[model samples]
Target: MTEVTEAGVSKAGVDEAKAAMREIFPETPLQMNEHLSRRYGADIWLKREDLSPVRSYKIRGAFNFFRKAIAAGAKDRTFVCASAGNHAQGFAFVCRHFEVPGVVFMPVTTPQQKIDKTRMFGGKFITIRLIGDIFDQCYAAARKHVEETGGMMVPPFDDRDIIEGQATVAAEIVDQLPEGVIPDLVILPVGGGGLSSGTTGYLKDVVAPENFIFTEPEGAPSLKKSLLAGEPITLAKLDNFVDGAAVARIGDLNFAALKTFSADQVMLMPENAICVTITEMLNVEGVVLEPAGALSITVLEALGREKLAGKTVVCVVSGGNFDFERLPDVKERAMRYAGVKKYFILRLPQRPGALRDFLNLLGPDDDIARFEYLKKSARNFGSILIGIETANPENFAGLVERFETAGLGYEDITENEILANLVI
Candidate 1:
């Protein structure tokens, strides 16, 4: 199929997809954000997909899938899916809307909160099954069940139907833009590339995709690695912190849809930096954003003032299914990335007044967030675990200087993943 056709989902087809969803939910807002716009010297509009009924754009795809399947007289067939997060909730909500029987397969290790939310969304319309220890195993079981029962399986981001369903997001973005205002750049967060591919297809006529920038989490750079290698490649390792957009590999159909794009268009955002964005949005704007949801906005800093000056930019805020229970973790990561927090193992002289001397060296703005005597390594030296938070990142220069002047031996463990994960 020609790129313009989008594997047969045209712009009109995208509009039709949008119309199909009016029965269940309204169009999401595309508000011009004054805060971001002023900060970056650009007119920044946010395509807030986080505002959907399911608190994400996932519902749009699932709802469209159900509509098309039911229209084809497949409503009587049992539907199935395998997911532990947003996709599951989306599928469940769509199942209830159509009054269709459905099943969701999730890993045994999936968090209880996710399981309960999926059950709540599906209600009486769906059944939950916990299988296997990881996603791949659970997904295999889901596929096997589909084969045995001839049930339809709703894939997360790997099918033409799912991509077509996601294309509706672009249609809405076009409809929502202010009169006579054309977007200079469109920032999209990429995972399996469903949203990016779908939106790219829909915007072929309306906007030049040369203006597009796609972002993925640094630890899970499937798309970027794939693009650089000139084909889709699986990541050697995956980080589930940005769960929504942290895929080990890009989907076949979705990759095909985006293969023509240059590798340079795709950028990687550090997972820690994304957490910083999350915390900043929560504290400064009263906006709660999951790491993936904040991807598009967070990458703006990487673009800096030169590229964004006097331009109109649109950022797609994909999902906001953040759990407040993870707030402390998020804050810790944010503080580290911003350089205002540090963890260190100080080789303190074993003396009655060593702690007092260390405390005196810290400035008024510096606070000892965590202090623990790890071990008495020698007769003369003890290892102390210390976590310090300062008002400014620059304060670290002064801190290290003070330590050297006092002849205090220290090792910063703030960026030491293995130790930080174990202790902090």
Candidate 2:
């Protein structure tokens, strides 16, 4: 296959892709987010890809891939893909729309919510196979099946056609904006780099490349690390919390499209900070965003109000296939990041007055969210796991001062990932 050049993703190609996309679904809304705009002191517009049919921009690529393949007179009618997230759902939805047979491979440990949704979208047009314990293993199995069966493989990213299809998002953004107004910045969240690369490619043709900013999860800084190294580098480990954007390596075609950019163009967003954005969006704007979908909005903090003031910014809200089961975890992480909640291991004396003394130390705004005895059988002292939520972070300092004054023994384990994971 020929390399995807900057010239390859031309205005005409993107326009064609957009026109083809109109047959499937209407353009996602590009709404001026009043809350975010007021907070940042900028005109912040959100391209709501989360509102897409599959709750993501993945459908655009999947649909375009299928449309182009069939149009090319390819004999292989069967399609196969491996994904445990939005891609699988998008591919399945496209398969149903195109009326083509599809085989989707997902890890055995894939959540039932995602599996059921994929099945629901594909209906009778697709068959899902739960194969491996991990994504790499599932992907390998999918490749082997396609190799043996002579079926077409719909890669999550890395293909020119897929990139072209994803570029339609940029086309829509440009067309949807009010006439005579150009955005000063466009924030894109990068995973395998399909969305970022495609959107940046098209936007560069119409606008300046300097106007683009790419974001990736801090734990999975694939594009940022690759750009810094001047080559694609696979990460040894990735925090899959941002499941939709935690790519170990940027796709080859995607990197090719983005290679000329400097590392400073990409911002690494902390997973916890993203949770804060998710919670804020949910509570303030009544918008539910998955971790990946929240990346663009979360990075606005890193951008700073000084730089963003009076600028017209567009944030691509990538996906909203959030599992509500993770809401508690999200809330906990958000609180911790906001400094309003913390966990501590308290060594309480085995006496009746000790519990009351510790309780009295808490400020009026402080509340104990969790209390559990770890080593209750101890003769002198008992190990107590305590979770505290406070209105202000300064309340913790006062409580800690009280602990010192009272000679109470305690260890704050709020920021200790290992200990918190084991107990909290």
TM-score to true structure, per model: 0.98, 0.97
Query: Could you give the C-alpha RMSD of every candidate to the true structure, in order shown?
Result: 1.4, 1.9
lDDT of 2: 0.92
lDDT, candidate 1, 316-382, per-residue tens? 9999999889999899898999999999899999889988999999998999999898888898999
> What's the CA error at residue 113 for candidate 2, in Å?
0.8
Q: How accurate is candidate 1 locally (lDDT)?
A: 0.90
1-424, model 2: which lDDT tens digit per residue?
Answer: 4334473566677788899898889999999999988988999999999999999999999998999899997535789999999999999999999888999999999999999999999999999999999999999999999999999999998888888889888989999999989999999999998888888888885668878899999999999999989999999999999999998999988998899888999999989999999999999999999999999999899888999999999999999999999999999999999999999999999988989989999999999999999986478999999999999988889999999999988999999999999998
> Model 1: residues >4 Å from true position, as ranges?
1-4
Clashes of 1: 0
List of clashing residue pairs for candidate 1: none
Worst ten-residue run, lDDT, model 1? Answer: 1-10
